[model samples]
Target: MSSAAPVPGRFTFVLHSHLPWLAHHGRWPVGEEWLYQSWAASYLPVAEVLRTLAAEGRTDLLSLGITPVLAAQLDDPHCLSGMHHWLGNWQLRADEAAASGNVALGRHEHRLAAHALADFEQRWRHGGSPVWRELIDGGAIELLGGPLAHPFQPLLDPRLREYQLREGLADAQHRWGHTPAGIWAPECGFTPGMETGYAAAGVTHFMVDGPALRGDTTLGRPVWDSDVVAFGRDLHVSYRVWSPKSGYPGQGAYRDFHHYDHATGLKPSRVTGKNVAGPDKAPYDPELAAAAVRRDVADFVATVRQRLIDEHDRTGRPALVVAAFDTELFGHWWHEGPQWLEQVLRELPKAGITVGTLEGARADGYVGEPVELADSSWGSGKDWRVWAGDQVQDLVTLNAEVVQLALDTLDKLPRGGERDRAADQLLREAVLTVSSDWAFMVSKDSAAGYARDRAHQHAHAVREIAAALGTGSVAKARELAAGWCLADGLFPALDARRLRRCRDEHTSTVPTGHTSAVPS
Candidate 1:
């Protein structure tokens, strides 16, 4: 008897690459190390995996979100040079290891170190690897764009929100050679009215966590008031790969993320035999870890395949399993992540799974019904507590105060050249005030001091501009603008006249709680 062929369903993966604007800034806790580590462990290695897949003609459908701020830093001359130097240093470290007595460590080190250096030089030496272009060109990956600096959308003043979205899209177009159809809303921070902004900017779809779908984690669907589609991450399939407690990385064979030697500053052992400390760790062996990677990839593929089969059986439609993750989690946190990714992509296709991007899935009619979305983000508790928590409460309050001040000042300015300049500065200040990085840093407790400093710096700029306008100090206003120009160098497309017009048109209709002083 002949057997029936297995039906294919949609399986999509979205990787969001984000790092704050950290160029020419270095101070340990939250500085240049963040960029270097991600480059070494994540970007360069991940690029290689995607490139390998494309070369094999197995360009699996994947969506990648590289935030504009991260793009700028990646393309910066200083960052490129620093990465080159770091890659060379890694080669030297590998050579030293090879000369040591440890044969297994030496073998793996020599191979990976050489591979990483060659990959970095060939792909990312100048500006950035054309990896993004190659992926898009080869149909291996779809690029999802985001705001210029990855600011939280809901908390930002509405006037500045448009500027952030517009400039962010413009930057992506300038760098990547095309405007994106989708966005990874910085931190998945979505609000009801933000849809109008996305619609105006031409973003047809964006992502949110599974919980944001009113607990219905299915395919992409439109929001209530707007035509734009929203896709929710499938937490069920995703957590299996990397959950807080039960992830593959926490397995005994994986390299320990927390216990790198401070003196050598390199990870020298695996988390072999759970509860064992780093100093007492077993010898490092890539072969053992590769076995673990194979097992994890199998688990992930089975999870995806089974989920799709179940959903297809239930709905009688090709169901989608959308898996989302931070790009850093691969190389930076889970050393075998790049390996696992390669294996998963290769194995899934052979298993009768149709790997696809968000856009392709939507185009194939994988959309569902619309619903009203509540305030949500993909943080620790799947809420806004990260941004509005006690750690950064003071900065949050200060941000609110300065935003209100800027709005108030814009309200009083006369419609002339001076008013125009003031409006531009007010918009700049307002957007910078709502950057999610500050609150995130504080909440993670990685660099609370730096976060507080950035918040205050932007707040000071807003206050200075407001003070200059209040006293009619045009010279001081120019000085403050020049000073603030150091950090808040975004929104070159911002037109003060439009803001002035918005203020003039909306003054009478301003809501009681809304800040109308700043033009939207």
Candidate 2:
């Protein structure tokens, strides 16, 4: 469209933003603090960046995946109040740090805290749904949604998978008055027949890791006659910005995410050098960090331009490159990441490179011919081993049992009356139990114990409520369900009754082909 022949056809930046249910859960070790930290450090600042761009009339190319569970938390009244209070506490902490002689760090945090507080009080007082809705409606960000609870869908029961996917889409519609045609499939995970389910739910496009296509990830291609396109992440580009061992974040000039000032609960040092002890680290100079952002931003932009040019020449057409990453990586993990994003977005267009949303690419007729995709995920080996391997076998079994019990309990419920709160609560706990986070945490040993306990607690809730019902004590079951709902309440949109059992399976909209897999 730009008449520049070698300009990369399109680049879509997909950011998946999610957190396990943590609102009414504990505070310190693995609970509300996790939520609040990401909120203050990531979501608020990221949203502010996007909103500013939107106000300046730049509305294209950014795709954000806010999982339904995450959406539930953002919209919940409890989380809104908690986030407000948390911001106030953040400012107070910064003030205390300032008085305690960490003046530079104190002033820096105090500014961030004050800005976050003002932003929250003025714009976010109602709830985050409205903020996200504005972005979606304004076309500043393309909204990518997923299952109600973000189940590792490939391993989930097919019927519940459909139920979760459909309900998840419906939840988006309920919030913003429009159903998203594109979804960020949880974990970028795919099982062969699952595309039919996506088509059935009206999803027109989704993402997967690059290796899912045997590393030929230059374009969005249809999977086996289904018009729904599957876009693969260009890991060469994504990992250049964020990989475990090395990336822009690990650069010496950036803020050190691990170094904490225990006295003030603040990070006060830059990444002085690789693996250097926290105490030996030098003070964080904002000027140095700012310079790193500029250098990284320029380097990343050049990387994209060259990547697109290479594909354009090889394929004789404008190529599409999707660089996907977690939304938390921006302001939370990388500190200057959001600033880097802002700069890259602003600079790409000026560089004569085409940048637009995945849908924009489709509308521009940029989709290539269909390709056969193997079962894959964005994990270590581009396989499902992370969620269903020896390391997490116990979690795998726990998830299967919880899901089966939930389906059985919901099926046995009497149909068509007032809402069945007990059965609804049972389903909520079951889905939460199967969140891919637990298995991932266990696999990575990030917080295995806490992940196991959370999964088991929710699974136990499902069993207790189901047992009470089976014992012919409806009153007792209701009481038990009410108690669980008090803590596990997030998706008010879920109905156990919506669980779909396949009716003959074949669909004209979705053409079923065959299954494929790669070894761990």
Report the poorest 10 consecutive residues by lDDT, candidate 2.
506-515
Q: What are the lDDT figures for the candidates, one per model?
A: 0.77, 0.84
Error of model 2, residue 235, in angstroms: 1.4
User: What are the runs in model 2 whose C-alpha is more than 4 Å off?
Assistant: 1-8, 500-520
TM-score of each: 0.88, 0.95
lDDT of 2 by residue, 233-327 (tens): 88788888997677899999999999998877899999999979999999998999999999998898888888888888999988888899999
Q: Considering only N, C-alpha and C atoms within 3 Å, which residue pairs clash in candidate 1?
A: 407-517, 407-518
> Model 2 lDDT vs. the true structure?
0.84
Off by over 4 Å in 1: 1-5, 95-107, 405-432, 461-520
Residue 153 C-alpha lDDT in model 1: 71
| Candidate 1 residue lDDT tens string, 206-312 | 99998988655667878877889999999899999887678888898898887764543567799886779778998767888999999989889888889988888
